[model samples]
Target chain A: MSSTPLPPAAELARANEELRHQLEEAHDLIHAIRTGAVDALAVQGTEGPRIFTLQGADQGYRTLIEQMNEGALLLSDDGTVLYCNACLAGLLQCDLSEVMGRAFADFVPPAFRDYWAGLLLKGWESKSKGELPLQTRGGALVPFSVSMNVLSFNETATLAVIVTDLSAQREITAIRAQVEEQNALLDRKNEELKREETARLAGERAAAEASRLLEGISQIAWTVDPSGANTYRNRRWYDYIGVAPGEGPSIGRAWRERLHPDDAPATLARWNESLRTGAPFEVECRIRNADGDYRWMLGRAQPSRNAQGEVLQWIGTYTDIHEHKLALERIDQGQRELLNYNEQLTRVNVDLDNFIYTASHDLKAPISNIEGLLDALLTELPAETVAREPVQPILHLMQDSVNRFKRTIELLTDVSKLQKEHGLPTEPVDLAAVVRDVRLDLEPLLQSTGAQLEVDVAAAPAVMFSEKNLRSVVFNLLSNALKYRAPGRQPQVHLRARPEGAGVVLEVQDNGLGLDAASEQKLFGMFQRFHDHVEGSGIGLYMVKKMVENAGGRISVSTNLGIGTTFSVLFNR
Target chain B: MPLQKLTCVLLVDDDQTTNYLNQLLINRLEITDKLLIALNGQEALDLVQAHCHEATPDCPALILLDVKMPVMDGFQFLEAYDKLPLPEKAAIIIVMLTTSLHPQDVDRVRRLNIGGFLNKPLTKEKLNDVLKNHFNRHLPE
Candidate 1:
């Protein structure tokens, strides 16, 4: 506060320092104001340094200037807003022009409007400064602080108000609130994501568990489409069949392809019926497995149906039943064979029983004719002439025939008797002497027939049997040998006995009209004979065989027709 | 049909004594003097049928056939006789006579419409027994 006076050089220097100091203060203020929104730089006119002051002038700019300096808004009495700044109005989404001369109460939010008026009244009366919140048009609250002072200006007194916009100043307080809201939203979203992930994980776990359970099912579970194609299978089916899993399906065929030829038709028929009827299917068949062996198997299946009652697939299982099927077949075959064998045995028994009956009936015609002829001849012959002359020949023939018939009947009786009595002749006998006697007895007939008898009685030693039966056996054999003497050749006979094991084997071989193969088999029959033209009864040889058999011996014959015949008698050792 | 052409008859059998006696009885009847003679049944049938087919036809009015004979039996003669047809069935008289009494032969002979049946050893008395039944049936009708 000094008056103007100075030397030109001294005055210029002092004025320059003063002007520089004032310029420095203005630059600092402008710098501080321009730092946010209000530009406070003031340039001096070249003529002189100027001093200017405006009261209640451009309150919006002033307030803006204060707000830029980080200050609050000030309100006047009567609920009138004295000023607002660019920062406050802009944050309120309100125009600076609309904020000027506006009633502060009108600017208040409806909820806070009364509260604001009361607080302002109290603040003005008490001459206090209070912090308040103001509503922006964006519906956000802007914080502010106002100082009230009574002023006497012009004629009446009004409140001298100072406003400080605290929008940025309150920003520090609201940071925690923003952080809390963001954290809440983030937490909610994280929870939702966690729930979704858990659901997805549970689904995956269920799917895995289902797959594991599917593997544990051991049945040869197989699926086939309605079109008769295989789609799926379990492990046991292939394992039981001894084939590679899925091999049958891979070959463009179903598992039925492995069935044996004999079983294929039945298996296919059952399957076709099942498919047509939508019923359960079952079959047993032989399967040619991978190991190249055929095994029986049973397959059972049922159709899987959809909600519409349409068949979707057939699910089935396979089992091994070869042993059971084969066993049943074998038992059936055995029963059939047994039945056939029993039938044969019954037929043979009937034949054996009927043989004699049938033979007698057939032979009676000739035998009765001969009997009638004999009766007639006997009637014609005189009682005294019965033994004489021309009648003698007829008598001889008839007598011989009667004798043959009587002998044959006796032989038949002996054979039948042999069958029942198996008692052996236990007496020891000289088989050698008996055979010699037989040769001597047959000497006359043998000479007439030109038959030679060679006896080898020493070969078998002594045998146990009735000597009388043995003599008859040898005599019947030698006489039969002479009777069967051949036409062109003289008969040579050999009768021999040889020791065999613990007994004797007697053989009589004759060179004569030898027995034919068919006649040889029948040589030992009751009245069997070779050469119907030969004289004497057929029973001579027959009785001889019966005696031998009754003596615990066996009889057999070997012969070459047109050569010699041998009759063998084997006594058990 | 005429008296001079009165048909003759022959009977054949193996029993010679039966044949002689039957001839003696037949001569007494005088049915024909031109008597044909044969022993065996074959020769008898042949001689009788041979004489029958002659132009002056001496068809035997009666042939006494036996059921049994030697060489060829009476049954064989009956079989051979079946092959022949009588020119005049009334003019031919054939009779089966035998000692054989088998039912099968009795049934067989009943089917033959012969003159009459006469038993063996034909005497006048038994012959009259036959004349009563046969001679009455053979008259004009």
Candidate 2:
């Protein structure tokens, strides 16, 4: 190398060649420092090892590595320790000199030796990262996460690694798993608590329902022990018995005092029998009400048995039967009254029959004798004496009086006969024939009155009645119709029979002297006659009514004064 | 008119007036030659027995019986009369007379074997009919 001047261009070129030689030497030194290929170079009086430095930059990087929380190390291709930072030596719990030149596997636990070997087997071609355990010289274990990288320099291989202790991360993961397990346990306990609460509420509801049902029943319900001591009584029992609530067991014994005196002994005997035998108890007895009056009560009890067939208690109810009992008593009383009334009626009927029989016999006998005497007198009288004017007229008058007396007796006999024959059997009677017979019997009177009779029995010709009674009814009615004829107008009479519903109607209409309101009111009564001039015993219409009514028929008369009179009889079929 | 064949007649009645009037009528009719009178069936029975035991030529030819007497009624007399011997009853006519025309009385009279039944206050015509019908004799004018 020369320090010479050269031409402005060529001399400058020679001078630049000398300066380029000096620059090439400086470049080689810088390159050698950056590559850290230099050996046996130490930064004196420092912990830095035999490695090149980037002057002040290398110092900062070294400090960074030394203070880092992670452990840092450098290794040869064979996994031998080349350099390790203070953090790495501290992580292995060893001195820097003792860590140097030691194989990396010596710091790894025996459990992780193969894992470390697998990382070194990758050589310097790739970086390997894993979690591993490191064993200190004291035989203590340390957990670490390590990252290793391979670098080649001048065809020689080396490794760069980062090691992190992992104890804190694992503690955090275990805490999370324990917290999740605790939450699941809490959920199961909460479900069990809710189910228990629901069961308790249902039990309370069942108890309430039983209490409500006991109060709602109609009968007086009670319970007693097998010894006949009261245990419980429902609200109805207290209300019906008029006893205070919470009354003691003695209340049951007090009930005996309220029983009717007549029924007490028998009821007690029955109760004793039922108690001895454990049979169902039943009785109908009189119980005193709140008003202290005895009333009928039907009481019944059944034993509540245990599984062994021993009586546990008695459940009983008392039902009031007072009204029903009273009704039965009233019915009995009514039956007795009816029997008495029937007996009295029978006696009266018998007496009346006897009176009529005796009176008819006594009265008719005398009349017949008188008639015989009159006949004898007439026959015994001399012919000249009987033919004399005054004597004959007087005799005629006497005969007339006798005839009148005989007629009266005959009518009275008919009435007695009617009463005696009241229960005679009836048959189908031709009403038109009865009317015709009556008309023939009254023909002399009919001719005297010039009465015309019109019979219209075509609709319903027959009726169910006693023939004798029917004939009497027709005869009396026809005779009355003729006798009561008006002075001017010819007497007109109509007899009609027609069907009405389930019966026959017999109507006798007459255009004779009619009846006034007062006379009509008094019409069907015995001995009641409307006309004073008419010769009537007043028994005809009464007899007619009695006969018709006795046969279960009805008769009604409609009359207008001086116009007409009509009599309607409804005869049941 | 008068009955001729009847030799004697009996009248039985509780009433004195009835018996007297019957006797007078019998006398006027000349129906019987002799007249016998008694108060009741008991008395009439004694009269008939006395007359029959006397064995008179014309023992009471006719007997009049009345019902409803105080001591012995007509029916009882008839029963007693039946106990008499046939000779005492032979050729004698028995007739029943009653004031009652009651059907029961008529029925009872029919059951008795009497010659006839007549109403009370008996007249001559009835006497004549009894004589003619039973004795087969006519009345004299």
Candidate 3:
């Protein structure tokens, strides 16, 4: 413990430094007391020690701090809690006494401890504010904003801190954020509704266009459901039916009320079948028009089907067919009249034939009787009277007349028989054989006329014809060729048969006294003869023509005056 | 040779001229002692019934029949003759004479029980054929 002696100047500086240090210590003590870092102060007096409270010294200011909605607290420079109001204690869920003299860093949650240190450092320089969550006595966290300032109190430097509980303010901010997110979601939903509305509008426009097209058609169109219930009808349908739109009767009622009685039952049955089978319906019937007259109408309906072949609807139309029906009926009536006329003509022809036959037959008896009586008279006459020259000539003339009469009667009978032979049974007749037989029958005539005859039937040998008729036809042609021989020239005749088309043509050609055009026109007619010198009853050619034509055959004559004549017969097999 | 003479002969016809001619022919032939002449089949039948009531030599042995009469025809006369009560009916010869050889008449004549059919103006040759065929006799040349 020896001390070195200093100079007077050094000693004086030392004394000054010591006095300054003592003054700073005194200032710190006063700051702690004023800021309530120390609740009471102890003083040393001559007799004893005395205590003095620093709390509630400014009663009015304390009351103001307690009454404020915000929590109030005081923290020291070392981050220690010096004083806390009732609101701060409530935020911390603790008593005021628990908060006093406690480290503010201890009240701060671990997640906010670093933030609290930063605020304290900044507060020592001037003023600082920060937010942090504080842990309460019940273990719940409370949000708080702390404002710290470096201030001098009682000549000592101290930190003045004000703590505000921020729990309510943070809850308001979270609610506002939720409201903003809900507004964005509502805006997206509104956009989707707008798109759906546009699509629905387009579909409605398409349906309206289809309805307009259906209305403009010319037909009496209408539509119905699959059940045959009428859904729509065109204006034409209403006009045609003489009814207003929506005023037409049901289909079943219309069948009875508007349709002709004769056509109603059939039309209804057809319509029901179409509805039940989903088939196309077509029918012709008579319907009553606006003028109350029945007219023919064609009704048609078709079902509209889906992809699965399900009937969606039925489309129908009614067309007026009255004019066509009437025309057909007229044609049928005309045909019937024509048939009646033909039958009458046939009957008249039959009657003519029968009359001729009877006349010829009756005449035969009388002619034969006259012949017999003449013979008897001749036998009974005296020899001298019979031998007279005038008597002989007269008798010869009478006999000749009787013979001619008999020939005429026979020819007449043959002509009458032609009609009855028309339906005679036919067989395949050999043309060559028939021609040969005919030639033999006409051999005398051929020899007398010195006619040349040529036959060629090999090309078509057979014909479907009655054998007797065929022979008669050939004989008549050959005899006519010989009978009508030209003066001073031999008659030349040719017979030929050939196939033409589906039938046979038999031709007889003759070079004789041919007829002129006018005579040729009636060459085959009954009682028509161009030459009078021949022994003919003028019925041979007529019978030939009739026989040829009776069996689906035809006869034609071609002749030139003084040149030649040809007769052709076509027999259809 | 001349044929055997018949007991009686009958002629049936409608026309007066035909009946007279037939009678003259029969008379000229002289083939029977009795010659009967009638205008129609009904008269001929009456003559037969009156003269040939029994099997007698006076009964007609041959009869000539004519068709086309007003009351009765050749076929009708034949029908009545077939039912006659005369016992000599089967022994008599009958022939049909007509101007018409129409198919219907010819066919009907063929089906009848008559001896033969001849065409008119009854010639000697036709009568000879009838006599030779039915009566086993011939006409005089």
Candidate 4:
């Protein structure tokens, strides 16, 4: 990342020359006017305030004092303020008389007051120009660069001075460098901590002398040369293999000869390939231990090669992983058992569903007979006479049981319907015609109640389904909307279908006596009816859900307690 | 025109109550002289097929079916009915009555060429309506 070099010194000097020339012109004009060689045009101008000068030099001096931008102040050798210009008085936020003789140290902020004090001594003792600090009227510590000279203009040691504010430049530079240094120090500490943590947690601190370090580990570490021979062997490997370290015929082809007959061929091939390619070798093989039992050992090797990629030596380590191998065996067995268990659960679920549907289907007729018998018995007896009779109440109780049985029957039927709802042939069916048919079917209720039923099918999209099922869904939902329309709000049911993502969005919204939040949970539950005032088997939504689900679709509801409810169903394409 | 009574009626149902009530109702109306009972659609199909070739016309004239039955329901019966051999003497009029609140069942009955559907607890009025509109037994002279 090379950067462009800045301009040469001569070009910078030329720019500096131009700037100094401009500075000299302004400086000389101010000095000459301060000597009162000319009239002050501002005083004689038409618009300015009237000023009468007794001496031309005094006028020029006043003009120069007003024009100077710096806060100029002159102090007596005895530390009294001899003169203070308007700029200086404004800077101090005080009347000229107040500051004209005040001690200068009182206004400078504490942090830089010593620097100002030092510079004050420099004027009488040694060099007269230096950098100092001052406190603004607002109490801010401001740094100023001062250039002063001991002068003989009035036959006394009057001063000629120039001051420049350097506070902003200095603060910007100091804070930036300080923040960068702190960040760098924090980074260095974080890196060292990271290294120490890695050393402690991962045991990854490397050793430069490999042979001396490998001597202390539980793992069996050794060197194997390019030819299928052990150049060295660790004591752990010899002990585990039921062999003495040096009692073996020198660490040669003896180990390979000791490899179990089953592992020898594959191990020899992998080793030869590893040496040929100078690739790291890793393998898990069983070895006979001192206890006369076979244990799984994970072997890994790093090949040290010369410049020609020729093998120098191979450092190999072996770790016993018999426990891990057995755990994997156990996991495989558990997975097989789990698969068998899942199959059993599926079979049981199907059996349960079948039992429910069969039992409910079988129970329906007897319960129906009880209901019909009770109705017949009631009709045979007098209605008014049975209003209080014990037998009548008992019959009513039977009827209640019969109703519950019927409800259970309905639920079982719905569940069976859900199971049977598969593979329905679909094609585009006119929703408008379905809506019209539903309207015609509900005409009697609409006419009797004078519920203003409006069917707006012009904007609805025709979705695909079995026309019979779709018609029923539309009719039941519309009738439900009309039946449950909020009392006194002029029952308005809006059934609109439109194209939505991957399907049709059918929204049946109504100004109905909306269901409470508690009831909303079981809104689509079989035999769960929210409002008893309207005639509902409570299976409408359940049936609707079955139909939609069977069609690979979904339906949902949103409602406000007193205001309204909307049932929006989305059918998949 | 003269009103001719059915010789025998077939009652097919998995439920004994529906069979009994429908039998009683048919007997009370004197719509048939003999009532034959079949537990399922397969039985109904077999019985009707066996009696289809009657020499002296002592066969079932009407068949009442309960839609939700085990083994073989009304729809299954209709599916099997098309295959069963029946004679002109049988004059079999298949009528479906189900307790299913689903409109799909009613639509399915009409579409499958089954006679018709009515609410359960089969009534005399419903039977009379079925006879008048479906069979139109008393044809105008």
Off by over 4 Å in 3: A1-237, A248-253, A259-284, A298-319, A432-458, A488-494, B1-12, B31-63, B71-89
lDDT of 4 by residue, A1-573 (tens): 148687789998999999999799666666664774432222222574332222324656766875687766655555555555666766666776566557666776777667766777777564577776677677766677777656443344544445666766688889989999999999999999997686444322222234556666789788765664666667777767777767746633254555667887898789788887887888887767767677777889998654556665678888989899889989999999999999999789678767766777667667778776776677667777778678778887888888888887877777676666556788788888887888888889777666766556576567878787788788778778778877666777777788887688888888888878888889988678888788778888888887887788888999888888888888776
TM-score of each candidate?
Answer: 0.29, 0.55, 0.61, 0.42
Best by TM-score: 3
Q: Count the backbone clashes (under 3 Å) in each candidate.
A: 10, 2, 1, 2
Q: What are the per-residue Cα lDDT tens digits for candidate 1 across B1-141? A: 322324466676665555655676556555457555567778977775676565344556666776666888877877777676645555566677754244456677777656656644455566555545555422121
| Runs in model 4 lying further than 4 Å from the true structure | A1-218, A221-232, A246-288, A293-316, A322-356, A374-408, A411-573, B1-7, B41-46, B54-56, B66-141
Residue-level lDDT of model 1, residues A256-285, one tens digit each, is: 667788989989998989988988999878
lDDT of 2 at A198: 74
User: What digit string (tens of lDDT, one per residue) describes model 2 on residues B4-58?
Assistant: 5567788888866567667877777677678888788999888878778656854
DockQ scores of all models, one per candidate: 0.02, 0.16, 0.40, 0.21
RMSD of each: 23.0, 21.1, 16.4, 34.8
List, residue by residue over A1-573, the lDDT tens digit for candidate 2. 257654689878988998999788557666764664321122222464444332334656766876899888777766777667777888788987788778888877777788788876663668788888889878888788888888544444568789898877788778878877888888888888887687556544543544466567898777767898866567876666677786656554355777999999999899889989999989999988666788898989888765567776777777888899899899999999999999999888767766765676566656655665666788789999999999999889988987887777666666666676676788999887887788788888878888889888888857889998889888877777788888899999998889998889988899988999888988998668777887788889988998988788999999999988898999887
Put the candidates in DockQ order, highest first: 3, 4, 2, 1
- List ranges where model 2 is wrong by over 4 Å: A1-353, A368-396, A433-452, A527-529, A532-537, B5-8, B45-61, B76-93, B99-109
Which candidate would rank higher by DockQ, 1 or 4? 4
TM-score-wise, the better of 3 and 4 is 3
True contacts kept of each: 0.00, 0.29, 0.71, 0.29
lDDT of 2 at B102: 56
Q: Which of candidates 3 and 4 reaches a greater DockQ?
A: 3
CAPRI-style docking class of model 4 based on DockQ: incorrect
Give the Å shift of residue A545 in candidate 2.
Answer: 2.5
Model 4 — interface RMS deviation? 2.7
